[model samples]
Target: MSAPRLRRVAVLVLDGAKPLDVGIPAQVFSTRGSMPYEVRVCGAAPGLVAGGDGLSYHVAHGLEALEWAESVFVPGYRHPDRDDPPPAVVDALCAAHARGARLAAISTGAFALAATGLLDGRRATTHWHYTRALAAKYPKVRVDENVLFVDEGRMLTSAGAASGIDLCLHVLRGDLGVAASNHTARRLVAAPYRSGGQAQYVPRSLPEPVGERFAATREWALHRLDGPLTVRTLARHAAVSPRTFSRRFVEDTGYTPMQWVLRARVDLARELLERSGHSVERIAAETGLGTGANLRAHFQQILGTTPSEYRRTFAKGE
Candidate 1:
């Protein structure tokens, strides 16, 4: 059979856009040509769109790009506090969304999506720093900064900066499959996956001192999910007392030590289920969830589905 058609992606660039937000879907989706996506940069009227830090990007397409796109991505912009996308942009977004085009807004791009009322009464997110503003500005929209991304069917939103990559990879995983998404991730030198429900903010407000060791500890944990880990053990690794570690860990990462570990194990289990032919019990043991029973329970609690169901949803070829 001939190769399947590539999906068209329109990256909507606004003034004061962040380069990474626009670059992410382009790079992550098209990097390996495994599940290649056709990425086009478009703007309100097309020409020169300003980016962060006095940089300017040229756009060869305009609003017309949305007409043929299978998905549209709104990159983060700097003026989310007050700026609104021109009426034309909002109207096109609504039309495209109504026609079943998947819509994703990165960081403050959610502000534009919210302005169009597309996210009304739907759970969504933006940069953690502006989630409050988003909630206040659009009371009907449920803003959740805690998640890396919110997959509300056709409309999606992601937290600040790097989370855009997470959302893009999710789209790839759902549209393509495990092996394809993993290929893209490997080409980009990024972690294979981060689940959408992963926490975006700390469990509590953090002091500067606690912030220093927080990320290092989490990176350390990501490599050790297959091992037995406890809050006390994590405390030892961080050189803090158990109580201090628990408090600081929650304050800095928004997840308890056990909660974080559970998510990590479940996420790893998902990848293995998608990529490998291993039995659920074997996968569970490998990911350190102890048994298939435990894995099923955690998947139900954290992911709202069973392991077998998840495997069926994302396993192997699409």
Candidate 2:
């Protein structure tokens, strides 16, 4: 028997939409192999769609195009301070979701989708810069500021500009398979996936001085990721009791000491995997993950892929 045909994806373009975000979903999803998607750009009106940069594009399809799509993607726009989307646009999105079409919002486009009330009580995310505004404007929606995107079943919301690509690749991976998604990423020269919970580019507030004890101890731990360092050793390095150091580290970094260490070790492992040709076992040992099996476990848990696969996909060019 033959495989099913590719799904149809409609990229809903609006007046004042950012061209880059508008193009990402269509570009990524359309490159997934012979059974590639059919991508159509549709506007709320019947003609040219004005872009964020004061340019206009001729859109051949109109709102009717969305009715036939299996999924609909709405890209970010520049003037989100204005609450009103054309009634036509809102109605089309509402109609699409009602008919069971998956709805996706890229960056500030979450504003458009949220305007429809379909995202109420559902987890979503948008650009880190506008997270507060999104939450304030749409109180019923659950906004997660840290994630690259949220896949709340029927609806999806992505973080800033580049994260749109990440969200599209994620959809491809989920709908197709890892190999298909990786192939699309290679074609686009993009990351295969960045989990939804990954931090957005929010600027960290300056850390408070947690006394000299906490400061010295974090530095000491940073230098010893390959060693068997624990909270007890960290407290000693800080010349403080373990209890004090644990509380101070959490206050300073917004994560517990062990959480910070694990993140650091994973980062170290990623660096080694990308910059060097070391086997997973060697990189695992160097990063204090102990064994390749343990490293693979953490890699899959945190990165959503095996270490070897990450290396194959993201390692320095051949």
Candidate 3:
């Protein structure tokens, strides 16, 4: 009756590191009974490293920390487009990869990962602002600017600081299974699983024409997801005509009101599949999809997997 050994994770702090980027992995993989990870915050050298947004980091370990780590995270730094990472830092990252440690980059950290030449043949992403620069600087790397993150097996990259959470949760799910990852996400108050392939940004009209106009209606719909809901019903709640509601709702959320409702239902179905043992038929009824066949079709179209298959992959106590 011994406890499981913890995985070693190192957050490699580079000069001009972004604070949120450094904090994401350090927080997600922090050692605790609930999380089976031991985090070490290290720098290029054991000293103060300048940071972005007027912050800084001081570490107790240097590149040596990567030697013992099972995973090494490179947090984004400022002005990555201005210069290459230090040669020794790049070498250390390459060596870590050579030794079978997973390497992940957040935001502009992709610049440093690319500098090591390990991402030459891999698909990667960075904060949208830097995607073109990242591609121009490293022609050999396949830079996909649209995704929230990309998992190229040993090397992973995320679009921005927030997506770093999605990346870490992804890694956690792989190591501990969906149930555990979901529990951790609940603790972090984050979304349980946002597919890495999901777009980093969605088109939304700015200055939101329907701002707050239908916020209450949306909230109302969420609570009544299992019940019959329609454009007319939602419009009634919003005190508007159906035609006006449909037009403005699309402009507001970048989705027809029905499209928004369907996505919400699918998201609810996913949660139920992971946490509950209800049969697909029951889940379909509860999510307003009406029948098992309908649920399967929607799940296939939206998540690329059937409800039963999703349950098998992510259901609790499986």
Candidate 4:
């Protein structure tokens, strides 16, 4: 039998495009040895398109690429909710979706997809700052403000610039299966398979405690994960009453003492998983979580994957 054709993926560019948003899907879908894809970077106006970073892209293909594509992607633009595309561009987007072309948007790009009326009666999202504005402007589209991304079978929207990677990975997982998606994620040094339904605004930074006294106490807790580590123990180490230490800990680091300690334990366990051939039970004991089963539960709760799965994804020379 004749082989099936490679899927044609078109990325719609526009004036004032966010460069990262444009680059994400283009880089992601171009991974080889996966479901084959032919990526096209197109613009509505068949000429120069400027990006938010003061860079210009010479787009060779016009909106006609949309008509020729099997999937269509829209990237974020400056003031995307306010700077709506020309009627012709919107019509082209709508037409592509109507013809069964899978559609996706990154960050504020969701505004462009929603403007096409294709997102009407469909759940969508944009950057957290603009989600309210997007919903107010297009009452017909269900603007879910919290998720990293939304995948309504063929239509998708992502929350922010980095979340664009998450959404693209989600689309890849659906099309190419877990193994291929994992390979691409490893190549890019990205987290594969983040829950698209999770809140988009989870903070990743845990800065060092502000004051020297609390800093030493934090370090003390770090070294004692295998020992009894109650709030009082930490307070004693800091030379303060438990109540005083708790308040200072929260003020200095924005997390409770125990929370910080738990995070440290998890971090150590994760490093062991990636760096050593240690068993999960041994790693759990080393980190003071006690057993493999306990570590598995907490690891899944925090990282959204089992310890062994994470090891497989990050192990050296894999």
Q: lDDT of each prediction vs. the true structure?
A: 0.82, 0.82, 0.86, 0.82
| Lowest-sum lDDT 10-residue window in model 4 | 196-205
**Candidate 1: tens digits of C-alpha lDDT, residues 5-84:** 88888999989999988889877756334665788889987899989867779999999999989999999999797888
Q: How well is each residue in 1-318 modelled by candidate 3, as lDDT tens digits?
A: 999899999999999999999999999998899888999999989989989899988899999999999999999999999978889999999999999999999999999999999999899999877887999999999998667789999999998899899999999999899988898899889988653233313221122334667899998998999999999999999999999999989878778888888988887888888899888899999999999999888776665557776667577885
Off by over 4 Å in 4: 1-4, 195-318
Which has the higher TM-score value, candidate number 1 or candidate number 4? 1
Number of clashes in every candidate structure?
A: 2, 0, 0, 0
- At residue 70, give the lDDT of candidate 4: 85
What C-alpha lDDT, on a 0 to 100 scale, does residue 42 get in candidate 2? 89
lDDT of 4: 0.82
Error of 4 at 222 (Å): 30
lDDT of 3 at 2: 100
Which regions of candidate 3 fall more than 4 Å away from where they truly are?
195-318
Global lDDT for candidate 3?
Answer: 0.86
Candidate 1 residue runs with Cα over 4 Å from true position: 195-318
The full ranking of all candidates by TM-score, starting with the best, is 2, 3, 1, 4
Q: TM-score of the candidate numbered 2?
A: 0.64
